[model samples]
Target: MRHTPPRAVEVHKALLAHFGPVDWRPSLPPVDELVSTILSQSTTDGNRDRAFERLKARFGSWEVVRDGEVAAIEEAIRVAGLARQKAPRIKAALQFITDRRGALTLDFLRRMPVEEARAWLMQMKGVGIKTASIILLFSLGMPAFPVDTHVHRTARRLGLIPPNTNAEKAHYLLEAALPPETYLDAHLNLIRLGREICRARKPDCPRCPLRAMCVYAREQGSGGARE
Candidate 1:
């Protein structure tokens, strides 16, 4: 990542070719995104969405969520797994935003520098780099790249970062590899690859479009399906 990673450009192009254009638009308000992302931890997408929907239905507003009974909140998001832990974190995040910004909105982050915005959100309980970056890139259209489990795995396998790199460090390494403009598409595409072809338990290396340039694929002797 000393310079624009020469491999990253090819990886981006190949992923786009295989996955088609990644047309991502913000799907939630920043606050909703923050809460949903917090709920997404250690859970599947279906579970995360279900939990968010239930939480929203149970508490009609962020203010209500902040002040509502934690037991009630925990019950609503129980399907998400670790409901006990997530419920309090969710309440604390809303409370922090209310306390610091004097309201429930995270819209103010949209106007600040990306780093400043990231820093501000990370101040909230349970809001780490991944959660903050998701709120930034997905909701606020900022340039911060979030390194989730899928992304982290795919990045290392592709030799984009050091093999032993941790998720936090991999975030910056990937940011340094691809341009800001490619973050959304690249991030989504990498996650797709990880889920479909480069899966955690038994990656389908032979069927992967990235097999030609992927370090793991080459090592496994699986040529690119497309290449």
Candidate 2:
């Protein structure tokens, strides 16, 4: 059976009881978060961090990065991997923002409805639903649920969402099912669960807090259930 909103809420509560509260708030401006999220694509967090720091240290400002040579941008973020692709995309996103809004700031999104803001961000070449939701929720403090790989996988295993739902559709569906206030905590906890317990390969389902409710755990039989 497809999981209902109440079941999703139950999963959220169980996760909270296990992992406690997490602060997923973004400490950077929207533009910075946008670039950081872009840099994070197909890379480890450590590499993304290094690349972001390097890019900032080299350019000192988004305006400079926006106008800087593509080669320099690629070199600065080389550690992130896919610099050839990410560099031009990042520059193009910034340029698009600058041209459309007459500035590089994403603060204006705070005034737009959440969906409107997401749509605006998605219009950028490299920004997809996940990236846009990250920018909206983390940067703008808006109610957007970003369905990253971890969240997507965890949700499917828990039957909170369909197993075949695409990340883009999962983003909207999850946001609709979950309470607005639960988005950040749920997002963080699900990611932690995916990383530490409900891993992609050979999940440590025996120790998972959601094992009782997870379809994947049940399918794994008693081996996944702790004594």
Candidate 3:
């Protein structure tokens, strides 16, 4: 853990204010979220959605997708930009879940504590902390905050976290401070804020709600805190 900063709280509040009552995530079966998150790794959401739609349309069921040919799965998700690499892992993850729990329902993971569920998800072949946290937060509605590139960059710029704070450490640091109930909405709000205002290359500081709290903005003198 690191020293707490007032800027962090201010930025968090400003993001929540702008993104008001975040509710973008849809409840899905845990396996679906896991698969979708994997598909989304290096691709846009539109392409990932297209790939997911193809998988659903082609397979007709999760069971079919789990047992389908790797090539077929790759073809279905080709639009996601890494189908060749992602295909086997996605299939393997589905198989892993079904083998362990018989069903890929959110109930299995959602029933456990965040730490335990995170461990369970990480056991899957392609799932890492970020992916696992996503499953816990989005699928199970658990108190796991996932830090993507946007959140990581914004936190660093706002001086909410120290330089080069890895996503795993950042996750723990953030979750420890915020109430568990705020985890879901905060994650969404932060992502929206990151995309809309606190962009990586060119932050819209003048129009930003948390402009007053941004160390990078205050330090335009330091050439804008390039990473």
Candidate 4:
């Protein structure tokens, strides 16, 4: 038998039906996506985008960012919050890529095995599993699954992952639970659900399409128990 969550496929299908077509495509180039994701840490989408635009407008290229002063980078991204920290990581990541590949582009990861590519990205100064996975999956179309805050919370509520699983562990659990082909759709739909319905403070369980399979809804006495 496949060592997968029993109802993982069912939950994925329900989310797809609820969200309609998950039209998530790789929007940014690999290097841009990498830097954008780093800026997104602990910040709202609007703030992240503003910071990214400012940084881009200021430097115009990652190579310049790599060679630029840390103070300049930090000033460019102060709106993203934690610029004092994120700026260094972003610059360090760019430098690491340049040093390792003899170029500033992340295009080489396309030819490596997905796991190897993911591991290589994580070796950068501030890149972690989520950031690396997002870069590979979103930008490079690799099979890696990214488990963000929304994905982690929703998966646990749906009983697809163990309740005690942390964000890092949830990455592997969710990747194993769903098929590689469904990774992008599943990841995007889960985030939509979490942000729109399964909110942190007020989950609209009764309206959630996956409520029938959600342990959180059942625990709240709002839905039938999962079969």
Model 4 ranges with Cα > 4 A deviation: 1-6, 223-227
| Higher-lDDT candidate of 2 and 4 | 2
Candidate 4 residue-wise lDDT at 91: 88
Instruction: Name the TM-score of candidate 4.
Output: 0.95
lDDT of 2 by residue, 87-195 (tens): 9999999999999999988999999999999999999998999999998988889999999999999999899888888888898889878889899999999999989
- Model 1, range 17-111, lDDT digits (tens) per residue? 99999877898999999999999999999999999999989889889999999999999999999999999999999999998989999999988
lDDT of 2: 0.91
Give model 3's TM-score versus the native structure.
Answer: 0.91
> What alpha-carbon RMSD in Å does predicted model 4 have with respect to the real structure?
2.8
**In model 2, where is the ten-residue run with the lowest total lDDT?**
218-227
Error of 2 at 207 (Å): 0.4
Candidate that would win on TM-score: 2
Score residue 125 of candidate 3 by CA lDDT.
80
Each candidate's TM vs. the true structure?
0.95, 0.95, 0.91, 0.95
Clashing pairs in 3: none
Model 2 lDDT, residue 2, Cα:
41
| Residue 46, model 3, lDDT | 99
